[model samples]
Target: MNEQERMTRRRFLKACGLGLAGLSLSGYMTYLFGGTSVKDVLKSTLGGTGADGFRALENFRINSVEPTPNVQLADYRLTVDGLVANPVTWSFAELKHALTEVEQVSDFHCVEGWGIKNVRWTGVKMRELIQQVRPMQTATHVTFYSLGGVYTESLSLAEAMEEETLLAYGIYGKDLPAPQGYPLRAIIPRMFGYKGAKWVYRIEFTDHQHLGYWERYGYNVDGVTAR
Candidate 1:
């Protein structure tokens, strides 16, 4: 669909009251039917209470409206640099093809105390990428950078290597919605959503510990949950 049509659908979903359950159903239907448009997929995938609340937090504005240098698939490049021996730049399609696809069904919990019911995600294992990068002995943390200026997050080498952590390309069985971080987004299960950085653009292998945007703003950096 064109940009204008996409925008109109986003506006409609924002104004609707279907909550998360209805949104999940919509996403399921869209995935099953091959002919659904991008706008329709978005209306369904983004249809959830957590999304509604998040949109409200942003004053109902679609967060992806602004073009970030890092988020565009055409202009987007995931730079695997810093401490790596072979610093690489990957196009979205290149990365999509290079990585193996894996499916995950897990509960998504937000630090705000709201949780989405089980959802399935399709993406590549982050460990696989790290293995490919082969960080040097000095690299201790993996810092994530988004297209928008200075929006960053970090994970210790250990956290970054988790088998469950993924650089996700699809959600609920379809391509991700832009607001939900299309092209790619990080999904670290059991952590707060902020730790799952949205609109992800780059991955920097770092030797020093660093605080991300939210971490610097007082959200917990080590987002481990206590059961």
Candidate 2:
């Protein structure tokens, strides 16, 4: 879809309040463009209640609007390349065993003004992956590409090295559900949700910052949450 069309769809989902309800996990392009009724979409996708009536991925019933990517854990490969001393590829098993696993309770803030609090996230710190590959001095930024192939997001090398920045694979003590970016995703707690690119499969260190999927259509490049 063209930039204008993508922006329009984004506005539509935001208006429907699905943007923060895990519709952001994958672009709801198929459902939105296929003339599915808003009522139907909401009915299928949004039926979960958490503490204080807030909804989170753990409790949210995920009804994928797009063809969910079939990712087998054994076959999935996460590649790290570009401007590094040693390019590396990791299988799901290797990643878990090789990296220092950590967990934290962080909040997910969407730009639409809704947030999920005290989210339990489990993953390896991005810095741990960076240390393994050893980025060159000229590599000032890193871009993460989703497995779905359309979505991408970038963060500065410094931001990626932060303790809270994680390449997360599980949430709430369970493997991420298919609709929630199954094998992997980035978790940038300080940034808004879009900055935490979902279904991510590739990481490339670059000399310049690459605009993310949302940022290309005028969302802030520095998507730090106001809170």
Candidate 3:
């Protein structure tokens, strides 16, 4: 990474309280092998150099550093409320059986500088959900709630209504994995990962935008990644 990008990464990490910049765990490894630090090990796992053996990231993967929620689809409930004429709570089966599933291949990018490409996401369109609830004219943003309280995020009405925005229920041609938000989750291909709320269960349409968990920290509110 260049100096400017390095500065941005450090700033972001500091805001997230994981400032893994220069505070290498190299000191802890010194005692293990004749005082020679194991700096390369840390690099390999978190930010490996593009060498022949080290794998940086996996393709068609969905990931979150947060604690994954344990969910059983039989009991899952997705609530759609706020600024809507008809509020609805959809059961897992209702969504799965009622909506025609669509599969999309898109890249998932992280603000921390890594990306997973061509993720096969299968779900109903985000617009379809909005259509069911009939978002009021006053609704300007749609807030998503996930397993963790800090996992809340929002998208502008225009962004949330895009054809590519999805409430994904499956990935890689199978049921969504718990680590990747099983039952349901928002999958907006254009934004950074934080905007794709994991373990998402609730959608609330509102008049004003809410700062997502990361946005409240230091990440950009307009988290548009390069196409």
Highest TM-score scorer: 2
lDDT for each residue of candidate 3 in 99-130, tens digit (9 for 90 to 100): 67899988777776556556788899988878
Q: Sort by TM-score, best first: what order?
A: 2, 3, 1
> Please, what is the whole-model Cα lDDT of each candidate in the order they appear?
0.73, 0.79, 0.76
Residue ranges of candidate 3 with Cα displaced over 4 Å: 1-65, 225-227
Over the stretch 104-155, how does candidate 2's per-residue lDDT look in tens digits? 8897777765556678888999999999999999999999988877888999
lDDT (Cα, tens digit) per residue for candidate 1, span 45-155: 566345432332232123332364434568877888888776678888888787789999776766655555456788998898988888999999988877676577889
lDDT pick, better of 1 and 3: 3
What lDDT is reached at residue 164 by model 2?
95
Tell me which residue pairs clash in candidate 1: 20-48, 20-49, 70-147
Off by over 4 Å in 1: 1-72, 225-227
Cα-lDDT of candidate 3: 0.76
Return whichever of 1 and 2 wins on TM-score.
2
Ten contiguous residues minimizing lDDT sum, candidate 2: 47-56
True-structure RMSD, every candidate: 15.1, 13.5, 12.3
Error of 2 at 85 (Å): 0.3
TM-score of each: 0.68, 0.73, 0.71
